[model samples]
Target chain A: MAHILLIDDDAGLVDANKLVLEAKGHEVSVAYTGDDAWKLLEKRRPDLLVMDVMMEEFTSGFELARDVSIKFPDMPVLMLTGVQEHMRSDWKFDEDKDADWLPVRKFLAKPIPPTKLAEEIEAALKAAKEKKGKRPS
Target chain B: MAVSEKLKVIVCDDEPKMCSAIKIILDGFRPEVRTLGVEAELEVSLVSTGEELLTRMETDPADLVLLDYKLPGISGMDILGRFSEEKRETAVIIMTAYANIETAIQATRLGSFDFLAKPCTPEEVRYTVKKAAHHLIVSRHARLLAQEKKRIRFQFISVLAHELKAPINTFDAYLDVMRDMTLGKDMTAYAGIIAKCSERTDGMRKMIADLLDLTRIESGQFRRAPAALEVAGALAAAAEGVAAEAARRGIKLETEGAGLLVEADPSEVGMILNNLFTNAVKYNRDGGLVRASAAADGGKVRITVEDTGIGMEKKDAARLFSEFVRIKNRATIGIPGSGLGLAIARKLALQAGGDIEVESEPGKGSRFTLSLPAPGSIDLKAA
Candidate 1:
């Protein structure tokens, strides 16, 4: 089980996601804004970060993601956004762009199902472990 | 200066011959008024009284007026005062046979463009008309430009307001579902419903925030807090941001070439980096690789992101950086994007004396290179 940090402004959604993530046997902590997320980050490094794109400030998650990757290179981020629903488009996330800009591993549309969230979290942890194996000694 | 081609010049006098003489001189004399690729010509209208001139003005305002101080049924001075009160654009040239220093001073005080005595030379009539017409054209152009700016601003605000419909509608739908709840009274059984409600509301909150950010950027009010920082920190921060998403998709996100210093606000630079990095992750193949590496190219420092994912056609890539444009493709149809990310990224990059460049091909991978001004190199303007 991996440690997860969930940052979102909605208390209800945070509680729901926490319940779902914990049910999958992982440790979870939550913050409601980018500032609070940073304060939480100062205390511990989570294995993965689950974030909302628009919170307190638009693109705040993107900012937090940037800070996390720089401060904790090993932590992975899963971005949940409603941006797609409002600005519908045929656009795929491209990683070849600087990691600093598109720092999240996945851009999942919000109102996501609990099963899918848990599954993605599991997949992320597995990938992290595999990445550690491939790193240079 | 060329006179306005359809310039209307009104001549008011109780004496028909006086009006006729002025009309004939103006009709033959073309006023020189500067215009933007448009010729100007004087079209004269003769009125026997101040009331007649004012009535005609109500329907078709003159660009310039030639009025006699004495008239029946309302003095020319009263008409001039009315024009002043109404703030008409028509430039006035006062003409009276009883011209005196006091009357001339009064016409000037009332904002008349020119003052002339009766039986004035035709040359004097022509020159005054020319000066007044030129002033009219310049003010007209200024008004047009201001109106156009207001119209564009209104359109932008409307589009932003329209965008609010999505979240509100989604919330409406969520409420409808809640109204028909079949589960027990305990809220745990309604966790999903509660979650959905929060999601919609959160979406609205986010949309509003993005709108505010766009406004700040466009208004030129976004102040920068530039500091000397390491490019590696930005890279690592970005990598950390997408680590989960990349890992979930089995995509490899690796950052190389650490310790390159750049003069930038970490958050601003981080924003650019996060956008590109997120794009790389979201568009990649299930097991593809995304590599972000920083290097110095001449006097500039660049962080290049290369992805082995489903790329784009050159045509689609060309439109990617424009505001509200999103590439429609089979591979991207299910993806959720604000469509403003790249546009915002490009703006912030340019403001920082840098730019984000893209090279992609269908079925192949894509490469994005972001270049920033190196510290002590390239004069950074206050943005």
Candidate 2:
């Protein structure tokens, strides 16, 4: 079981996703605003984070993800959005840029199937675990 | 009979006599309009302040406003500024007794529809109002046309994005699947999937080709080379292209009533049939039956494709011939298609002096019928 944080401005989507993720045995915490998400991050870190593109302030999620990755580089971030293509174009996917940059582990377009979401979450968790194991003790 | 409609007007002036004179002129004009059997009833409202004029506008919208240039709290130009800011559709005609040419120019800059000098004739007032009404009508229509064009452009961009993304994403997914050996070295199964993916890619290519072709045809860049051909052979070949896909899904694809001849470009006819057959297989239920047939009827050859798949609702069926409209179906998700097949096919058929018809219901599936002129009826050699 994994503890996942979902940050999005859409209240209904947050509730629905929380229900689905919890039902799959993952403990899900949701933040409808970017400030609330930042507070939650300071308190406790989750194994994975799912974020939306547009929040109260435009591109708030993108900014928060970058900050969180700098503070806690180990945590895997899964970015989800309706405008995946738009985001993909804006963020120019590349790994060699900067360490402060939040390397988005995965991206799922909105209205994603529950099965696909679960699969992606599991894959990301497993990869994180293997990378930790490879690190010097 | 056409002249009884009320002429709604708003009069803004600090002076009571100016308002009274304008009201008297309009009231007298109303009776003359009625006598001429014109639908013009004059309804006027008087306001002393610009604020009152703006507030009254919310409840009682007028067709025209007679605004005084000199007023108490706010001038006529100030009211015009408010009108411009509020984006009011009503036309404003500036009224100035001590007409300073400068104030009239300022009023014009502030968007006054027209300017009226003091002690103006009732004839001038009547003619000005009539011209303002005509101007309003023409401007409203132009705005509507501009808005419609913007809406169409937005729709085209949305469709273009979907059309481009679907094929590219499908190609990427298929390439990933092939590279990973997700499906084992069972060459037959591997070959089948690859073939299906390639066919879908081909469909995308053809849709792009058709889009370009239609653009060319509409721009008068394309000329047809029509020929007398066997309709059955062309349709059969198109059906064969999608036969493997149907078979894979356990659907029965059959052709009947062969040996029909038509006067058309064989390649174009084949393309139309290919699109129809692809749609039939793409939208059909697993184990569905698709039948393609052609027959000579009256002076034309009728080719029909009937499928037992997920049918379209009446609303969708109505727009089937329109460009870039895909029937929303659960089974069609993740499948790559531009939704241009039927539109292109219809255009091709029309160019060949033919027409297409569709009969469909939400759950029962659909039948597309194409009617084309019989072979040798039209001069195919020069086409």
Candidate 3:
């Protein structure tokens, strides 16, 4: 339905997500780091961005998302994080509190099932289109 | 409290009769005092004024001081201040004629163990001295236990890094290879499972790297390969490595001071500079600047990293070098960090006969200065 760009340091996770998105009949591009994702953004823009919070640097994905929001305003971002459990902090994404800093349309913890991941992709894409329509044209 | 040892109790009373009376009462309380780890025979030192007490303390510091407030030259209040400043573990029991609530509060604030009125009975003196001795033993044990806990924690982190990170890294790499395999339709069903495994392994990998970094610095491994190297060369090498990333962010990276030399392992020097540059780039505002400069002065090579980035609060800076502590706030929320970088860097600097200093303002910028002993400047034989 849409072209999705996935940025993650974990090659296997990127592959798995790519497979699920492709099976759902969407084109997917994978980037192994924030730097790679930025370089790719130079040549082409995807319908949506899916990224892990920690990559080559722990906050790389978050910074990349902020950059995207500034440069590619209409592009939606979905964040995947794997640090909460390891940090032993009871952290959850609160839209109102985190919206300004996180700037992501959707946040997902790691290990999402393929079916659920596809659903999230579809939901994110639909929301992005709605947001774009609401913007003064 | 151990019953077999002896306690050295110093009694400072201007009156000889008063001292003799307290000594007689202490002799009777010997069995009770010995229970607080004092020897069966009490080693008692009797002094008449603060001057005599100070001289006696120099020769043989007592476990407990039974002090008189009205001394000839230095008042007991002054001696208390001196003892607190010296951080002497010796407990002081002030015997005062002005044993009002105010004097007691003043004495206690000066760290007196207890206060006794001038006409206090032999029994009162004996009981107060015994309690002071016991308090000393308990606090001494607590101080030792606190030190022991710190040592154990350092050992635990070192062991975890050394034992756990390698295998996890190997397993993570293998998982990546598996994901790369073109197994077509059959592998689709297991894609989610493979991805989950990969993410878990990757988390372990990051943790292990941080752990190893912490252990290497804590265990004095940085000093393992010491050699004379150019400080500016190490800075250039580190800057070159991160140049691409800095450019991608539209940040400027500049380095100067070409020939300053220091006695340190090149790799360790590289690591210290790399960490500083990475932080300067990572923490800076978009399109901000990072400048690194090195110089030799007073037999030390000083390298400074200055950045136009989000600076930190002075209070936060105090705890920055402690493990597992990261600066937490909105500006830092999106920035990921292990919180061990500065701590490890400081340890490495120490091992390399150097140190790191930081200067920052909330929004202006930050400057980190690392200094290492210049080659031939420090006496190797003495070290």
Considering every candidate listed, which one attains the maximal DockQ? Answer: 3
lDDT tens string, model 1, B31-57? 554346445677888888888888899
TM-score of chain B of each: 0.68, 0.60, 0.55
Off by more than 4 A, model 2: A1-137, B1-9, B20-44, B49-64, B70-90, B98-111, B117-123, B170-197, B214-316, B328-336, B346-355, B361-365, B370-383
Best by lDDT: 1
Candidate 1 — number of clashing residue pairs? Answer: 43
lDDT score, candidate 2, position B91: 90
What TM-score against the true fold does each predicted structure earn?
A: 0.55, 0.53, 0.44
The DockQ-derived docking category for candidate 3 is: incorrect
Docking class of predicted structure 1: incorrect
DockQ of each: 0.02, 0.04, 0.06
Ranking by TM-score: 1, 2, 3
In model 2, what is the error at residue A94, expressed in angstroms? 26
Q: Just chain B of model 3: what TM-score? A: 0.55
Cα error, residue B359 of model 3, in Å, equals: 1.1
